[model samples]
Target: MRLSNKLSHALSCAALTLAATPALADTVWLKNGDRLTGTIKVFDGGKLVVETSYGGTIPVDWKQVKTLESDRELMVKQDEFTGERAKSLKAAEDGKVTLINGEAPKTVELASIEQIIKPKPILEDLVWKGNVDVGLDYKRAETDTDDYDVDFKTTARHGAWRHNAEGGYNRESQDEVTTTNNWNAEYALDRFLDEHWFWQGRVSYTRDHIEDVSSQRTIGTGPGYQFWDDELGAFSLATLVNQNDYEYKDGGSDNFYSLGLKWDYNRYLVGKTFELFSNGELGKPIGGDSEYELDAEAGLRYKVTDWASLNMKAEKNIVSGAKDGEIDETRYSVGFGVGW
Candidate 1:
């Protein structure tokens, strides 16, 4: 009888512990006398985005949060401080935070915290996210006309390494005459050397009918610097040594060396509903008679839903080495895109 009673007590205690686990989930306490219990996705743009069981996702202003507690590890960032991977952070009295990162217990004021990111689980740690946009049109007035455009982007991050790729194609035909035909693709890989320094390698291929070029290929690698990385914007600059190869329409080919500079920036506004981005690349020949080349784009995107957006973009491609009549090409387009 005694043995049976002991076994029954042990099983009862186990059941109660399992049932109480979820009740002790992460929590956020607001200064306005509100308490939210859910998973905090990230803190950015002065707001905290949380995923809840009953309310989906909610954005709460950071200033309104008085305390936070989580059982999972988080990537924490502060002004001028590198990101710290921490776990078991809990709120204490007097607007303080407590966590064990590596050393002994550490405490900090709530206001000094800039951002907190949930650690990605193994299944989603390296998931890719990006967008694709396509535009098409046809006309049958006096003459048949067809136009098509496609743009693609994708990126993934793992540990200190990041990878990005983008490409696009455009075509226009009027009465069986090809008015425009162009396509370009690029891929870049980056490894963060430190908080503000990184190394990158990139390769690109282009074919421009207007420039009288059958194909252009470039391969480059160099160091880069991150000037700023925050909720409002991120700006980066890089310089590289490029090997350029160009094939002309008249069965001519040229290979040369060039120095390339790249600039990329992004901005978000209106609670992440509106976004503006621009990236440009410039290549100046170092030897073998290759003129300067410039490729750039500026775009504004408005989110219509979680996965859908309306995008307006302007692009320019210039090759000073091109034939006299085909030196510059500019385009503007609007389209719908899906993002993951």
Candidate 2:
């Protein structure tokens, strides 16, 4: 009885060991190299016991085992366009699957792919300079004039600041032989105070000659706030003070100071300015005009490349006192420029 009991205990332990082993699924590669589905029950020295979907166990030689498949699903959805499919068994080992030409197979570890789908760098950030533009203008007082202009401009940015220099010449010979010449130089510095609030300082000089009789020299400085900075574009608001010295062949020299608001919508666009100014000189006290002036301008800008662009502007000037006059001016220009 002791021998029989010892034998029974050994048999029970053997049965428990067999029950604890996991049942594996079989991946059957067809003769034509296609795949079929089944489960594997036992794999001994030289034979495999496979369980088919029809609920029968069949024994086959190990030499006939063309492929093996895990029961786990190993596919991942790649994109919204293409659909999903079973990753090849090789992909499961590598932890990643790649579908090429919608059919070829490639595999990579999941950790190796962490950087693949990340955001790409912006194209605008990579550019330093290039040029091109076309524009139109119209101005009316007692007489109306129409003008068309084309311009090219360029710019460059370095470490903490950028500098720009540009010049353009235009001609309008309808009623009078009027020609316009303009040159501009500007410098801007980007400053960071905290995270959300930052500051910018800009200095710009401009020389404009109109109709050989009127010319203006302007120098301006200002502080600006950047509200947005991203790959698409940037938006900022600035308060500026400008000094203008005007020389007219008929009129005397006039000096003016302007306080204005400026906005830059994008790398290639700018808009909206409202200016209030005071002329420093007094003509006559009793019957003379007041020295205060108001000016407003709106314009559009386009960047052809990092270093070139075109601009169109319309401005209205209103003055007070004897020197008070209303002037409507429209100008279009393309410029080639460089900066750093």
TM-score of each: 0.75, 0.40
- Give the number of the best model, judged by lDDT: 1
lDDT of 2 by residue, 1-340 (tens): 9999999999999999999985655465423454545654433323444556664445454444444444433322232112223333332432343433336655544333211111114422122432344555677766666565543334443323444343334445445545544444445554444322335555544444553225555555566666643322345666666666555545665666666565544432121111111111111122223344443334544444433434545433334442423233454343332221
At residue 11, give the lDDT of candidate 1.
Answer: 100
Please list the C-alpha lDDT of all candidates, in the order they appear.
0.80, 0.43
Q: Residue 323: error of model 1 in Å?
A: 6.8
Q: Count clashing residue pairs in model 2.
A: 18
Tell me the spans in candidate 1 whose CA falls farther than 4 Å from its real position: 1-39, 44-66, 70-89, 98-115, 123-128, 209-211, 230-233, 288-290, 323-326
Number of backbone collisions per candidate, in order?
A: 0, 18
Candidate 2: worst-modelled 10 consecutive residues by lDDT: 271-280
